[model samples]
Target: MQTLLKPSFTRETAFLKVKAAEDAWNRRSAILNQTLNTKMVRV
Candidate 1:
């Protein structure tokens, strides 16, 4: 049950949204890097 952050969010919600986005981005980047490294090693 997470709170939905909308355009009209308070300071705390804004920070939460930013942190969530950053964490997601970091996870994606890590997965992409690992995939690339595996392909490079196989080649």
Candidate 2:
């Protein structure tokens, strides 16, 4: 399981955590867009 970033985290750790979250969000968005496009094309 991913460790939760707490207030005691170092600056570098905090930055890495933020970057990871952004990457995850982008990935999910891409998947959602692809699914929507495919459904739209079929309609």
Candidate 3:
């Protein structure tokens, strides 16, 4: 993760990496929210 901020990496590379990571986390968050909602409805 720190590699994304290292000076050795190009700006485009870092930007793309950050964007990809953000997208992945967003997807995970959505899934977690769905699971929590389902559990709450069951209760």
Candidate 4:
């Protein structure tokens, strides 16, 4: 009952955390990649 709900809730929280982290990483990566491309073009 309560124990089963706890596991599902915990999984949901963990998934949210992972998703947020992945989104942040992807944003940073895109910015860095764009900057690198511009620099490469200039060079």
In TM-score terms, which candidate is top?
Answer: 3
Q: Model 1: how far is 41 from its true place, Å? A: 14
Better of 1 and 4 by lDDT: 1
Predicted candidate 3 versus true structure: per-residue lDDT over 1-43, tens digit per residue = 3545547779899999999999999999988778533755453
> Could you tell me how far off, in angstroms, the CA of residue 12 lies in candidate 4 after the best superposition?
0.5
Model 2 bad stretches (over 4 Å): 1-6, 36-43
Q: In model 2, which range of ten residues has the least summed lDDT?
A: 34-43
Over 1-40, each residue of candidate 2 has an lDDT whose tens digit, in order, gives 9987768888999999999999999999988778533755
Report lDDT (Cα) of residue 25, candidate 2.
Answer: 99
Greater TM-score among 1 and 3 belongs to 3
Which digits, one per residue and each the tens of the lDDT, describe model 1 over residues 1-43?
9997767788999999999999999999988778533755454
Give candidate 4 misplaced runs (Cα > 4 Å).
1-9, 36-43
Candidate 1 overall lDDT versus native: 0.85
- Candidate 4 lDDT by residue in tens digits, 1-43: 3544345457778999999999999999988778533755453
Candidate 1 backbone collisions, by pair: none
Q: How high is the lDDT of residue 20 in model 3?
A: 99
In model 1, how large is the Cα lDDT of residue 6?
Answer: 67
TM-score of 1: 0.61
In Å, residue 11's CA in model 4 sits off its true spot by 0.2
**lDDT for each candidate structure:** 0.85, 0.86, 0.82, 0.78
Clashes of 4: 0
